[model samples]
Target chain A: MKQKNDKSRAGRRTFLRTAGKAAVAAAALVGARSVGAQDKPGTRAAAGPVEGYNWNEHRWAYGIDTYRCIGCLRCVEACKAENGVSLDAHHFRTWVERYVYLEGEETARVDSQADSQNIAASGSEKEYRFDNRYKDKKVEKAFFVPKMCNHCSRPSCVQVCPTGATYKTKDGAVLIDHEHCIGCQYCVQACPYGARFFNDEERVTDKCTWCYHRITKGLMPACVEVCPTGTRIFGDLNDKESEISKFVRDNRVQVLKPEQGNAPTCFYIGLDKDVS
Target chain B: MEQLFHVAPYTGYVYPNETVFPWTVMIVVYPYLTGLVAGAFTVSSFYHVFGMEQFRPVSRLALLTALSFMIFVPYPLLMHLGHPERAFNAMITPHITSAFVAFGYFALFYVCLLVLEIWFVFRVDVVAHAQNATGLARQFYRALSLWSDDTSERARAIDRKFMFVLAVVGIPAAHGLHGYVGFVFASLKSREWWGSDMMPAVFLFSAIISGVALLIVLYITIAKIRRVPIDEACVRGLVYALWGFMMFTLLLEGVEFATLVYKGKEGIDIILEYVAHDLFYRFFVFQFGVGAILPIILITYMVFRKVRGKTFITVAFICGLLVLLQVFLMRWNVVISGQEIAKTMKGLLYYHVPVLGREGLIVSLSALFGPLVLLWIFTRVLPPWLDRPATAGPQ
Candidate 1:
């Protein structure tokens, strides 16, 4: 009877060992397959897509041709209407600055026509007489520089937000999660471009979302779409043949405050050294 | 050029968004309050840990002041928040890289340490009150005593040892509290006025100076009110320390400014321009001339000369008030002036103090004084007096 019991125990131990080994082999195979799937050109990662969006294909970039901008301010008006941005001059998601540089002058006189009424009144003149100070100076050269959220690859606003409320989308736009934002305004302080504002009515930090609502659904951002001179261009930089990528490659494009090291995606043609 | 939102008029072009300084006087008051708390606790630790016998008489008082001030530190912060209800989200889901996220932890840790140290120091007094008092007061004292009736020699010895440990621990915690506050401003690389490596040291030393000066003023005021003789040695020692720290703080600030001037950094001229225009009166006149230099000279004279009686107390008292004002101005200059210069370096902005709005002067002043009221009530309960004999437990 003792001999029979020992044989049975040895058989049970062998069976258990075999099962454990098989399970380990199975897990390793599954892990390898998932990693391999992520590396495949068209396959989504095993963790799945970002909620309500495809993270694999879309990557956005913005371009601005300072030469083409006629200082019309249509983009600014359209942005306000589309985003419900406050009409307060101090609060702007996007604005246009007319830079007037005089001959033999080290500095440029820059003025933003924050009021839509003022822009509409001035119309699309080559020489906008907004600032009287620049009127008397000998005109050297002048141009319009439209500025907005740079949608930086390394956004300081996203980095400084204490609650993870401001984040970069996989599609290359920096967005603020209003519900999660505590409105500490650390993001506002962190932004080198002066892009963000604390929206008093919404009680959240607000900035240019790159028109996320419009962009994801295959529509141009309000600023890009409403630009009459085709000064503002928005497209996918990931695609080699996209107009934005071509413009970036063909032109000597510059970013505002590149010294800040934010690696901004907003490229500009005809960017003057004194624009910052 | 018409003034908008009462912002200071500007000549050059400012980004439209840069016209309004988002941070206000309330934000200025936030750092000032935290600095006081850090400074007071540190002063108390000088007696407890370093055995600075001269500070012994006021050690408990300093601790109480710290506690009271710390209680109100969050009020200004909450008032500044757009969503005050979700303020705790900073702690709940704090981003690792963000400097402000560590504030909640640092504040909570320091407050807990201070509470424990205070309770341990006052354990005997609480137990005695529990035993001797009657009615609801007895119950209150009993609860404060944590129901620990043990006040034997062994327990007292243990409390002393624990207090020593806490004081040793508290020195860095206090420094961390105010140093972290400095970090919040200093870490912003975007703002040239605030982005200085020297900011934390400047803040910490200024806090120490303000704390010492505040205690001196309070000690003198309390002595006068109670008709008690002032401790001359204590006052002299604190004045000497205050002077030393003040000089050091000024040197740090001067070095920061000199570096900016010498480096000729891109934004330095614009910041200097803003300082020259709007901040000239506040920075040069009040902060440097009256608040700093005058106080230093007066305190030095009081310390070196054989001045005493009403004259000594009066001069010291004035010096204390001046140093306090100096520190407040420093906070204002750092927080508000930092925002005045636009990031574009093209123009300046202005901030007008609103009288009745949420971030108004009224709310700010009340927040500043609320802690003093709390301290008064706290003294009524704990009575941080050196004359009282150590309470004996039931024999």
Candidate 2:
């Protein structure tokens, strides 16, 4: 009787092992099939429709060369006209800023937007024309950064938004779905960049879109297109052959508040220290 | 001009301008949190000061509201702060000169005072209530009262004496606690929008308005939800209070506006342009029309015309929502408008509208939703009105 029982136990163990092997084989087949389905039509490894599009793929960035900007306000004008931005006190898609830093032995000045009116009014092509005391030089520096949304990879505005009204596109661009937005302005507070503005006319908040409409259609942003000196370089940084990619790779790049952990996609090649 | 920016090669470690977000958020959240504090205390004052046994139904709820709101008070400021991690530094090495430093101290003292006062108020009942409470709540109230079984005459007398002292101290602490936020804005020399002695007074008065409004709304809503009969007389009295405070707030705002437009101070003219043309929708449409004027008219009509029950409560609720909007817009105009003017005041550029991708509407709406959810969930665990045993059932 003991021998007979041992034989039966061994049979049961072998049967159980066989069943487990069969389940593992089935799972592997399903996994391989799913991977194959995801792969590109031509390549075996082109797994199914690019399983999750990388956010960096859709990002369109613009880097302005402070040296090339001549304080011409054409970019501001172009942005306003192109975006139908109202001149009301509450609606600004983009704007220019002038910064003045006082240092010994050197006086420097720049404007993010090289506007003809600002340049003509200041009457000098260099830093001295903007500052009266720096005429011959005693160390005064002034510049404009032409600030806008940095379109960070891990945007705080997107993270903290409760309604998911603000979202990042696959190409690393941050855009607001106005239809979904409830005009709470919580994102305005979450953002360290202060890039947000509440549009009283629309009863919704607005900010720079990186000219998403223009860019998706294979055109430059309004600001970049209007710029005369080609100071603003707009391109997909992910494209290694793109001008923006080359500039960023060749020159040291800096982003605003790197410690903030937003990992901004927009990289400035020759950004001013005071303006960052 | 054509001059290039030559500094030490930029390593991107520059100090970015503190986003107007933190200030805007703080202004709204501070006032809202303070409103809850004042509202909770006002409810408690009826029992403590007036010796109203009828208010026992709401006593615990009020104390709970005060504590919860106090916890959330610093959240808005933290979200706004450039260095949120360094927020605790203000407490350890306080800048005595800054109004915020004083606000931090006041918040601490106010919480302690509220806790002690609550202990005294609920000392006897806590033990009785503990028999019914299970698990965590039973343990909580037991531990909270420090297991003191003092039923003696001297213990009661001591508790009363301590409570009286705390209540007396609380009045100034509460006033300073919320009023100091007003002082923070009023003290800003750079901001013409907030540069007014009247701001602190306005803030305090408006706080009273919001406080009463919130209590009335909470009381009515809770009564309705629980299918309990509300104290009609209290609701009527609260409506009158709302009318009186709303009128005061309106008059003050009118006077401030007149002074600004008439005096034509350096920054006032520019502010007028923004208010009249630029910010007309938010200022007139939302803040004044819907927020201040509409509610004022409705509540005034209801109070004087002897409107009763749900109609009056509905009007009062609308008034509360409107007043909240008024406070929110007031903060917006003050914060955003102050920054709209260029540092040089020569470059008058409009504000940039934030897209959803950046931190704009999403984060703010979430913060707002936080309090609402808390208030709702709180009602489930703790009744809004105090549950009183019948005369025959208990003493």
TM-scores, all candidates, are 0.88, 0.56
DockQ of each: 0.39, 0.02
Q: Which candidate is the best by DockQ?
A: 1
lDDT of 2 by residue, B1-395 (tens): 31111111111121112222223434465666776576567656666666666665565566666766776777766654433555565566543443455666778889889878867766665655555578999887577558766646787778777767776676667667777767766665444566677877777767667766666767777778778787776666666766788888778877866776787755454566667776789877987788789988887687679787777767777787777678667666656655554332222334443324222355567655566567677554443445445211111
Q: After superposition on all CA atoms, how large is the RMSD of candidate 1?
A: 16.3
Q: What CAPRI-style quality would you assign to candidate 1? A: acceptable
TM-score of 2: 0.56
- Return the lDDT, model 1, position B126: 86
Candidate 1's displacement at residue A102, Å, is 2.9
True contacts kept of each: 0.74, 0.03
Off by over 4 Å in 1: A1-52, A114-137, B1-9, B390-395
